[model samples]
Target: MNRKILVLFLLILLSQNIFSATRIKTVEFNFGGYYSATDIASGSAWTPPYIIVNLPETGIVIKNAYVEIEYLSSAGSAADVTNIDIYFNAGTSATDIVDNITGTQVPDSSGESNLFVARADVTSKITSWTNQPYSLKFVSVGSPHNMHSAKLYITYEYDDTSPIQIKTVHFPIFSDSLDGISGVISTLAQQISPVSVPFKYRCDLPESGITIRQVWFEIRGLRQSGGATTDGSINVNISGYSSEPTMTLDGALTDTYRFRYLSSTGTPAGFAPNTLQTVYVNLSGTANTNILGGEVVITYEYSNNSNVKLKTVSYFFAQSTGTAGSVTSFTVPVYLNEDGITIERIYAKISGSYDSTTVGSIEVNSAIAGNSLTSRIYQIVVTAAQISGFEFYHDLSEGRSYWYNGAPITISWTNTLAALGGCAVELFITYKYTSENKYTEFYRVFAGQTPNEVASAGVYNYTFNLFFPDPEYPVGRKVLRRTWLRGDFIEG
Candidate 1:
């Protein structure tokens, strides 16, 4: 009996050590709001203003992030290809536009026409912060298009040492067209009154053994018509879950967004698991106000139970405008703490101007590892007309993986065409490996950031701070992970 007890004690110790080692685990969260069958009119500005997606907070490390939108275009014909303009965070923050996209319409099983899907590589936008809200807007260019739905997928990694693990669920409440056009008695335009719009959605939280961390909701793209009389306000709340003035909308709320956040940190009641609750909203506001879209995001945090963790980091490189006909090569420095890192994806914003109406082209390429081109990473050939720009985000998984050795990740831009001049590029790369000593690092470029760090003859300093508190290993420890720097020229 004594011999058996000794062997069992040793086995338990060995297992604990193995599990405590740094490990990585990946997770993907999908949520969105805004589903409409009503065809948006041509030249409609960002209809259904935005769809909200809640992301994991600091303890979780994002490995890869992207957004996919599915919609219907060319409703009459199945063979017609329609060009649609998609904007991300439009008229809000981090506004990005992708225009002139020709989406091929496919036929469904019923032989119906016009189904389009578009994707955007939003790794940089999504991973920049934690527990933040993201919104997407759509614009119809050629013809009227029906927006089916919008969703966000975030793939992240976490480990045992993380203070907490987070999971989010989005319950879409009140997604319908509301036209407050005064004197227009249309079915779509409903008058604002108490109990005018009584909205409710069935919310079934996860029944698993988890604790509620935080809960929040957002009202997106609440704008008035072209001509309005007074400001607009809407009081929305979830029964038994909302506080006084759940969301206050009072201002030049034209094309604006609003949100409300509640956490256990301040509320003494402490949020309880609200399972099988029917959330209700009572919207009463001023007259002649148009509402585009809205969504509710609920985030839950609990003690991290996983022993594995993973992360993805990005480095930014900004290139200067090149000569008329030349290939400029940029050598991006390595600032990662670990050696032998592998890059997973590269996103580039290529810009140039064209004087003539003739077609022009820009060639961008990248090679990693050895100087002899051990790994051919990515190459993009963009052909544009008159004046246009390209935002190309490419994944390097097609080629064999090559280890980075603190050498410059070579990026070149060839703009030899005469029609296009002033070629420039902004590049960002996401790595595959996670740094054991860091969680996240930030870099910012500014002028006169400090008394000593001032600009000198058109040269400025990128000043930043790093703080990581490692109380103990494999436990309560915070570390610096990734960093990026981007700057714009002045007096342009």
Candidate 2:
């Protein structure tokens, strides 16, 4: 009989050990209360109070766990409480436990703790409070044991200034795993005065190159007071040089270069202020060349400002082409307004052996209006019989003619002519005639190398008086005579 009892005891002990090995341990918190057996016996109303719970961590696993809360009496001994409400992680509704006595007790084997409560119905669980204390009972559904924390809150009407009236406890439970998030990366490029600087970049991988989707940039360090400090803008282009590689890339390499303008930063100068402009260039291309290095050159114009620069900086990009290819190059043109000279009219005359073909065409243009004038022709020649007349006076005191005849005529003469010599006499004669009734008379005699030669169809006047042998008698006489006045003729 003793041996059989010993064997049964040993078997029982072995089973207990096995069960203990499979059981999972967990940590939980609860807000405790009591239930009345008389309430069930007499069918009285039972209202369960709730408690708040909190957890420190999130996204973990939980195994088996129970919650415990202590009942406090005014006299400091174990107190019997009724209508106890239980909660899990500050759940909304309370689960009722019928018990006549209360101190500290574990939930039942049904995974129903004295603090077990219903699920919460709220959007955000963090930093939120419920009207009851709650507890949760769960079994491990997956591997990798992890734990999360939640808040447990108890609701009770208390006297003013009572610290123990409202109590909160934290509890931990198993939850899902955490997920990782992605980060955003970007860059900016700008141009300063007196220089053009461009920013360049390259991905670590070249063969299977990186894809650049977007680019944004702005100019900084501008003053607000003067309009001199202003903002400028620019657009990026993808077209490359003819000698360089073409911008056309296959598949994911298309649309590799994009342009954007940046807003102004500082106040404008005067009515038209200097601006600090920013430009952005977006690139999206798969590198397929061995030479992935390149550069960007920023270009712009400075208006109403002198000694200013179009490009302030140049940016270098170290590239990994990823594959085998040559380096690509690109260029941009910048325009500016400058001060220029204005011409009204230009006159030119042709003389002596001027070649008609070599004369070239004459063109006139207006700088302000940007209009051009028609081309005109120019030529020079001599023709027909010529006769010229002039008066000469003999200046006895100066020993020279007061006025010389046949002086070279100029367009600038105002009053016919000016007496550059002394007093002289005037003589008239017709050319190619010698008879008394029709004599070829010379109009006047001047100091010239070819004095006999005359200009035709033109009037010649001199400041001196005429000196005929008999001045009064010869006034109206029709006679041709070769006579010299008493004066020294000046040579032209």
Candidate 3:
């Protein structure tokens, strides 16, 4: 997909009688954490500080990659800090273009400097990328941590062109890479081979039982040299569930059985020849009743060949720590809308200790959102009003609109309602972020805002100059043209 093709693609799609445009987007993966000798491992083409972004088995890849570094670790950099090599591994398989090349760490953006480290022009690799999990290996021949402080941005161009372009919303990513998630345990060993293809795969749960906040299922399979002949369908739902939590794909409300179509080339959802496609199920839902307290089964509906279907699967979960809080935050640094720029939304969970019947509010305030003086504020509802968790219908496109730029806002709450006091009545913020495009306080869009310290309880008012058919005249324009001729009207 080159500049010409991209433009042509957009034009061609727009020209469609039905006007179905592929959703084009960029997904940025923020990379941060402790980098030291402890993370070092030897191999040439291989390296220690390796990070993996487990992509779902079914999806589309549009373009090349980008690395934006807000902060880079100063681990191995010194007076002797040398150049380092970075490689983007295409699903751990073939060295696809843009996926196999290497680039030097952008010395200017390394260590203590938050900037672009380097971009592996794996455009070739990704252009031909079959739907599969993606991983990257960074080998520092000179200074380490030069690139670890960066974020990975990937563009996604899918065939589905729904009139609504808005997708999932998420909160900003705080430095503590593993903060919000809790009590995670790898319960089931990775299963190899679909021995009972088209049948159910089971994983037993602990007897004492654990309340699940999030369940991650990794479905993996390789392409059959020529093409994928497997159905590769799996449904996720817990029996004897304790609570009912809504589910989402990325952040949109979708069924438990996603990625039914893994193929991504010839077929709208078809896979490329010999390319691997891996699907990951990030399920967030509450059970009405306790889980069966025994077996957690994965029922497969169909598969062409036992070996061709999902050959392997991995299951894990994050346990909800029954803590109470004023508000939970899910903020992230995202873009409003720009060519090749990416965006994000928030997803949060209320402390389980709060009374489910209680009504509360979640407020999202951004630093730089569009042309408004104050950042846009969005309200999140879990179970009507009481905060429980991320619900699909409520979470999609809940972040900055395409008009907004990069501003990291705080997702906070007032414990006024949750003052139940039985649990820790604390407040959680997604994290603070300085926007790439900061406001000058006197911008054209003139973000006129009304600031108040008091609570309106969700009551607010707005006044706009709604009066014109043309952009030439400002809204609420009086008949200035007639005013100029007020003294004498020849016609009158």
What TM-score fits each model? 0.36, 0.13, 0.29
Query: What total of clashing residue pairs does each candidate reach?
Result: 6, 71, 42
lDDT of 3 by residue, 1-492 (tens): 000000000100000112222333333343332222222322222322333443332335444344322112232232112344455555654233232212232232211211112334444444343234455555543333321233344545543322112111122111112321111111111212222122112221211212211122222111010112112212222222221111111111111111111111111122111222222222222211100001111111221111211111110111222335523333433322112222222222222223333333433232223322222222221222111122111111233343244354433333344433221111111111222111110000111111211132333233322111111223211121100000100000
- Measured by TM-score, how close is model 3 to the native structure? 0.29
Rank ordering of all candidates by TM-score, starting from the highest: 1, 3, 2
For TM-score, the strongest prediction is 1
Residue range 257-304, candidate 2, lDDT tens digits = 111112111111111112212222222222111101111111111121
**In model 1, which residue pairs have backbone atoms overlapping below 3 Å?**
23-309, 24-309, 158-309, 159-308, 438-480, 441-482
Best prediction by lDDT: 1
Which ranking of candidates, highest lDDT first?
1, 3, 2
- In candidate 2, which residue ranges exceed 4 Å CA deviation? 1-25, 34-48, 67-90, 95-492
Q: Over 4 Å off in model 3, which ranges? A: 1-20, 29-61, 67-77, 93-116, 127-131, 144-151, 161-168, 172-492
Write down the lDDT that model 1 would get.
0.35
